[model samples]
Target: MVIAIGFEGSANKLGIGIIKDGEVLSNCRTTYITPPGAGFLPKETALHHRENVLAVLKDAINESKIDVKDIDVVCYTKGPGMGAPLATVAVVARTVAQLWNKPLLGVNHCIGHIEMGRIITGAKNPTILYVSGGNTQVIAFCRKRYRIVGETIDIAVGNCLDRFARILKLSNAPSPGYNIEQLAKKGKKCVTLPYCVKGMDVSFSGILTYMEERAATLLKEGYTEEDLCFSLQEHVFAMLVETSERALAHCNSTEMMIVGGVGCNERLQEMMEIMCQERGATLFATDERYCIDNGLMIAHAGAEMYKSGIRMKWEDCTILQRYRTDAVEATWRKD
Candidate 1:
């Protein structure tokens, strides 16, 4: 039984997980809520990571009912995340790997999300709707790697939600998107917002700006804020659902795994699931434990790579803020 400890520090949350043979022992998260008016400032994120990494790590290990010594390998997210958060987690992974004389696996942040969705839902070869603060993509597996079938040309779905949440003065604490979803329940969708999906790719920056302007106008015009919030969620999420359906149709695959922070929205999942049902495809959606960023996915990716005898040279291992999901060189799969 290979026991592994996973560290997810690629972004705002510190996700730690204990797993063996794809079976999760424990998964926990410590969310880093940014200060007001500060949207994921790199220095603040790094500082927060440095302060909480140890506590989160120890708690995860303790809660797993497994000894730290039993961990056969240490897994850490490599990139496609904030540089400071990734570096902070990398140092912890490096230390743990060194101390135990165990192998260290550097996992891709996006792959972690994808893999975790697969593990949670038991969906094999499912297409993916991966949207987050940094990424927006419609992906499918092919050629031993997930291929991007479509994506955003600009900002991600989650970023748009958060930006709108701030525009409405919703809490940036805990989870902004989740908060936005809550406020959306009270919204009446009064104003019409732009929805742009071009050839499998979507753009939100323009719509976001348009909505902001609309909201400002409505507010000055004595319209209720709830009406604006309602309109925003409906339009934004409708765009997401439409894009996902388009991807599902374009790929001709019904199996979709929605992975990322935005996946937590019940509305998004509901629409996607309905689309799949209509198309006779399966849609896999993981819970917060796996859906949100976490370390276990990274560890699992690392273990798979290591078992296949793939190892990255120390000199070549560096943090990447931008990595194409399909750009994975190789998985070290022996098959």
Candidate 2:
């Protein structure tokens, strides 16, 4: 019956959630939506987290219907994210832990997604295709660590999509990626884009660079934005699917799971499903609640760590901007 609260403001999203045992009690979040043709600045996103964290915390606690004293641990995403935003959430987590006299746990942002996805989908020892704004990796559990078998050499797939959305001046209300998916649905042509797959890893910056140049030429040549969006999605997702398939074959695992912000993409899921079906494998994914970056994941992962006697000393709680998934020891999982 371990109870925990998690604070996650790693990038643009500010999320707070409460979890008991392996079940999510409450999950609430808000994104710092930037204007069209602009990206979310770290400083501005941090400010947004600082201003809204308390309210989000309160909302989560209220919705969870739990007393402050019942919370046994306070957890926060400690790394693999924007430094300023990560620091902002860490501050709130530290303050709450001190005020409530609860233990504090620092969680890896990437591992949080993996843990949550496992809990939600009940997939044990699955090959993970983690795609997000800052990360793109094919992960498998080996000797108590999430080993990255394949990854992006340059910018992540999600970042490529977000930046391309900026080129088209798409709205960031729900998400720039979502807007791109919607536009892609309207496209009829499958314009070819650069697809770079080096061994098991996939590169997106080259695709992004070529697409940007083509967007300029195509827009002037009477090609619609929908056409460009469709081309980008098809090419990028194929790379991801191909890399994931390679990883699955190498690991000799039949189960595949997708996690992180971009894991919410239907098109990506569709492509992955088709790939998995052709190979007689299963694809595990979650809705935005578990797929997207949210406090529930941190809380869920941190609570497991806390139960395993992994607690962070107050003074030792520091932000990690480049925390790799393999850096942390997964003491919670035995298999």
Candidate 3:
């Protein structure tokens, strides 16, 4: 019967969600979109969250039809995100917790995604591929920790896609990645792009640099935007699939789950599904509702931690920008 409210403003999105026990009652969010050829800045994104967070919170509570006094805890993402935006959300969460006299819990952003994925997809002990604007990693639950077996050496795959989208001047209305996915569907050819995968880790900076340097030349030489987008996706996703397969083998796991913003890409999901089928494994994934960053994830993860006797004091609720996925102990899960 525990009720919890979670706040998430890790990057461009400001989300507020309410959950009762393990059931999500309301999930509300607003995004801070930048214009084409531009990425969200910390200051601007923080401003957006500050302006919209209250409205989103109000909507979440209203939609849930729950009284504020019934909430048992307040949760927020504390790390592995843009500093200003994370801090902005943390401030709001702390204020709300104090005002409501509820327990406060700080959650890791990556763990939030993983926990949410597990709850929504009902995947147990699966090797996870976590790809987002800020992170890229292949993880498995081992010894009460989300152990990272593979990761990006440089920029995340989503960042690579978003930067390339800027070079192509793609719209950021829904997202740069979504626009690229649409354009790639029309591509009939796969242009060769650098595929850099060193053992278990993948690198995207070299490929991004190569594309940036030769984009105009390639276009003039008869390659369309669709071709370039398709090629980029194929190479990067192949790298991801390769590393994920290795992680699955390393962990001796028969189930695979994809979580994070990039997990919403259909092509990536299809490729992973093929790989899972070949490996005799099950693939678990959620749509944009759980795949993209949202407050529900924070609330769910925080509630799990709280149920496991984890709590954060007022003085200990500090925001971190580089919190690793493996840093948090998954105390809530026995496996």
Candidate 3 colliding pairs: none
Query: Could you say which candidate leads in lDDT?
Result: 3
TM-score of 3: 0.99
Q: For model 2, state the Cα shift of residue 199 in Å.
A: 0.9
Off-target runs (Cα >4 Å) in candidate 3 are none
User: What lDDT score belongs to each candidate, Candidate 1 first?
Assistant: 0.79, 0.92, 0.94
Instruction: For candidate 3, give the lDDT of residue 39.
Output: 98
Candidate 1 per-residue lDDT, tens place, 1-335, comes to: 67778898877888888888888787877888975545777778888888988898888888889877788878788889888888888888888888878777777788878877777788877779998877888887776777888899999988887887777777778788887777767875468678888887889998899977777778888767677766777777777778778877877776878998888788788878888898898888977767788877877776666666677666555677787788875454211
| Candidate 1 residue pairs in backbone clash | 189-231
Tell me the number of clashing residue pairs for each predicted model.
1, 0, 0
Candidate 3 residue lDDT tens string, 1-335: 67888899999989999889889899999999999999999999999999998899999999999999998889999999999999999999998988898999999999999999999999989999999998999999989999998999999999999999999999998999999999999998888889999999999999999999999999999999999999999999999999999999988899999999999999999999999999999999999998999999999999989898997778889898999999999999987
Ten-residue stretch with the least lDDT total in model 3: 311-320
TM-score of each predicted structure versus truth:
0.93, 0.98, 0.99
Task: Report the C-alpha displacement of residue 139, candidate 1, in angstroms.
Answer: 0.3
lDDT of 2 by residue, 70-111 (tens): 998899999989999999999989888888888888999999
Displacement of residue 308 (Cα, Å) in model 2 is 1.5
